[model samples]
Target: MNKINIVLADDELLFLQGLKAILGNEEHINILFDAKDGDHLIQQLRDAKTLPEIVVTDLKMPGLNGVEVTKIIHKEFPNIKVIALTSYFSKPFILNMISIGAVAYLAKNSTPALMIKTIEEVSKKGFHYDEQVMKYVHESITNPKDKKTKSTFDANYFTKREIEVLELICKQHTTADIGEKLFISPRTVEGHRNNLLLKTEAKNVAGLVIYALKNKMVSIENDSL
Candidate 1:
């Protein structure tokens, strides 16, 4: 079995050590390193011989901060996924992180089991949001105060196959699952997904889902997991 390589960043020593110890026990998880602050985290990423597949970072840090680090990772190391682990579980915080390219968001108080599940799901599916986060996402789209400039879907924007793939993705279907349901190869599903990302100007799968929701391409009732 292939291990999931990850790096962790947190300012609190006890919390950071505890998190490391918990994740370190999982046979499928390999901790590449741990950093005490956002600056250190970026430096570690820059100096590493092998980059981690995922980075789990705390939002409140001394320098750069989790949001800043996430933005940097999204821009500089696009392949490396980010999971925001912070005490702030407000809807705005969660929505902000998702929009900025975090593939998962977790409260610092999240259970070890949930944390493990999130890591595995994100490793396989590219993003993982709990029901609560999903609710926030839906509400963010519907709430008039939180609304952004509306995007209109052009009839020529995406092929029918791409729309099907996007709908499946918003419904939380994996690439293999989508391929099986759509009668296409997993690689083809991936190609469609890549095109969707490019056309929507989305940073990741999470961004794509948000774009679909914002554009009314998919409804929460239909896409809810």
Candidate 2:
């Protein structure tokens, strides 16, 4: 199997090295390099012949903070998946990262197994929302300020089946699960999903969910999702 290469960044020497050592032992995780700060990471990216699959960065750093780094990669190198390394986060801070295109945030004290699992999930699924992140996302639905009060959605554009498919997608149901619940073939489910992507103009599954949320199409407050 081709290993997942990661460029991990943090200003703290001990923590950075310790994390590198822990993740280094994993069979499929390769530490491409560890940067002391985001600026250094930028330089490393420029120097490297090949880009890594993931860039795990501290939330706060000396030269450039996680937000700035995330924006840079999201704009310049959209293919790379980013995971924010943080000891703590508020609703707005974490939400901003997600908006800026970072896949997830991992607590600094997280176990090595969870780190590996998150990296794998992000690499495969294009995003990973841990329980903490999911809880916050669910809560955001009920807050008036968090809701997109003005929607640009054209309800007439989507059929009832497409809307049901969208709600299932927002609920994080797999295609197979969705098909089983909806009593449709998996191939048919994919066709509907592609139509959702086309109509919503979303880039990926995560983008689709974000679009749905922004359009007030899916709400965790009402549905079990």
Candidate 3:
């Protein structure tokens, strides 16, 4: 099995060490590096021989801070997913992180098991949101800002099969699961997913779900997972 390489960034030394100890115990998780501040984290990323698959970072850090680092990573290293591990658990914090390209958000008090599960899910699905985060996403979609322009859906914009694939995706189905349910190969599912991303101009799978919800193409009560 391929190990999930990860970087951890937090200003609290005790907390950072604790995280290292916990994640280091997992066989499939490789702790590539740890940073005490956001600036250090960015430097590590720049100088590293192998970049990590995920960055688990605390929101409030010394120097650059997590928000600034997340934005930089989003712009500079789009391939590396960021999981916000912060003390702030308010709706604004969650939504802001999501909008800034964090693939997952976790409270600092969250259980190690949940963190592990989140890391696994994000690695497999390209994103992961807990029930709380999902609720926030639905609420955000339902009550969009006045400045935000609503997206209109065109019936012919997406093929019937593509819609099927997209619906399954919004339900958080893995590629293999979507393939089995749709009677298609995993490669075919991936192809359709890529097409959906291209057509909608979404950066990732999470964006696809948001696009579907914003366009009223998928119902939150029925389609969200």
Candidate 4:
């Protein structure tokens, strides 16, 4: 199989080196290069012949932040994907990244295994937002403060598997958890999620929850979450 090409950006040189070492050991992920901040990353992108499939960036950087980088890449190089690996976990920051074009969000504490898996998933599926990000999206949209615009949901509109997947997602189940619960593989869960996103007309997993709650497919308490 062809390797997944990637560029990594972070402000701390030591952290970047550590991350580079960790990701470098993964045989499938090729570290095309590293940059200290978004501006440098953008310059690298412009200079490189073959654009990487993804960029792992820290939200806090010296020249430009991850959000700015993600926005620039989204607007200029639509084919390139971004995964934010940062300490900032605020609801607004996470939501802003997703809205602007980040395909994934990983807390700085995310395990290396999860980081690797997220990179692969986003590279293949075009997006991979973890449960934490999804939770914020869910709460923001479902919060009583936001005017809930009701939409008519027809159960008949979805297939049995699709509805099952949607329910698991609304419950904030991780891709692995949903796969285990449904006796499906993670790849299968990804497929179902992609379909749900399209069928529900939702932007991301959080949007799926909004769709579910707005249409009364899920309750506020969200016992599963």
Candidate 5:
């Protein structure tokens, strides 16, 4: 199998270096580029001959934050997966990043092993969340009420079952696992997943997760609903 290409963007020099060093140790990943901010990230992409499989970015930066960078990345290279690395687990932060097209949300303090696991998982499964984020999520579940409305992103693309499948996918269950959990056959799970990718117009599981996250169809917070 080919190495998974990765681009990393973060404003803090020390943190950036640490992440680079940690991810560098992973034999399965290849660091394609590193950037200090969104502008530099874009410039790096322009300079690169080929796109990477994933872009791990810090949520807060000097110029363009991770959310804006994610939106830009999706607009330009819709195939690349965006993962948000942040210190805060605020609801707004998580929702906004998801809204912009992020496949994974992880706390900055997460272990190196967890980070590596998240990257690998999102690469295959499309989304991953650390325990911290999951805790925040479980704490925030209230009855679904419309507090505010932004321009609704296009969720008309996916069928209800497809959406259901995508959510289960994000929850990090395998096809067989999801089938057992949802009382569906593994073959049916696979079919719904394929249809989910088609309807979401995403090339891979990461893209599908990004679509689900950005459209608010799936929440990073422990969604009991």
Candidate 6:
């Protein structure tokens, strides 16, 4: 079977190590590289002979966070997919990441299974997002005077799986948790989250949540976030 090549970038050494350990168990995944920050990730990408299929990254790092890393990766390797793993779920962050070309966004709370499942979906479909995240993101954003930007994730392009992912993301479930609930791998959940970020043009989880809320994609009237 063809294995999926992956790279991880995060500032927290312990967290990075823990994630690596979890991902190491997957048969189909191959971690090609790791970086302490976005700048290092870019340097590694530049120096490497082979490129990874996907990159899992933290949103906030010492220098050049996930969003910056994503911008570089998207520009240097348009074909490569990106997944943002973060603690913050704000609108600007989500929108920023989306603009930078990341395909998905997963919270640090996600589980290994969710990560795997999201990865599978992203590898196959090229995008994913938690349903709740999507709902919040859509709702938070409004007209930015750039009609072109408005048309970026105009609701029609989302698939069923992507929508589901978006919902969960908004709910703030970790990739692993979402995976377990959805009966998929954590990687797959990560992939789905990335797909949602890409579709909705969200920078981080917060941005996604705002987008969902602004667009009325997910309602906040009856439910509490």
Report, for every candidate in turn, its global Cα lDDT versus the true structure.
0.87, 0.82, 0.86, 0.81, 0.77, 0.77
lDDT of 6 by residue, 35-120 (tens): 99888999999999999999998877766666666767888888889998888665555655666687788878888888888887
Model 2 is weakest, by summed lDDT over 10 consecutive residues, at 147-156
Distance from true position, residue 96, model 4, in Å?
A: 0.8
Give the residue spans of candidate 6 off by over 4 A: 136-225
What's the TM-score of each model vs. the native?
Answer: 0.64, 0.63, 0.65, 0.62, 0.60, 0.62
Candidate 2, residues 145-164, lDDT tens digits: the string is 54322112212347899899
- Model 1 lDDT per residue over 1-225, tens place: 589999999999999999999999999999999999999999999999999999999987876778888889999999999999998787657877887789999999999999999999999999999999999889988887543311122233478998899999999999999999999999999999998887677999999999898767775584445
Worst 10 residues of 3 by lDDT: 146-155
- After superposition on all CA atoms, how large is the RMSD of candidate 6? 17.0
RMSD after Cα superposition, model 3: 17.8
- Candidate 2 pairs with clashing backbones: none
Better of 2 and 5 by TM-score: 2
Candidate 3 runs further than 4 Å off:
146-225
Q: After superposition, how far is residue 60 of candidate 5 from its true place, in Å?
A: 0.9
* Model 3 TM: 0.65
lDDT of 5 by residue, 4-54 (tens): 899999999999999999999888999988999888998888788988999
Name the runs in model 2 displaced over 4 angstroms.
141-144, 147-225
Root-mean-square deviation (CA) per prediction: 17.3, 16.8, 17.8, 17.4, 17.1, 17.0
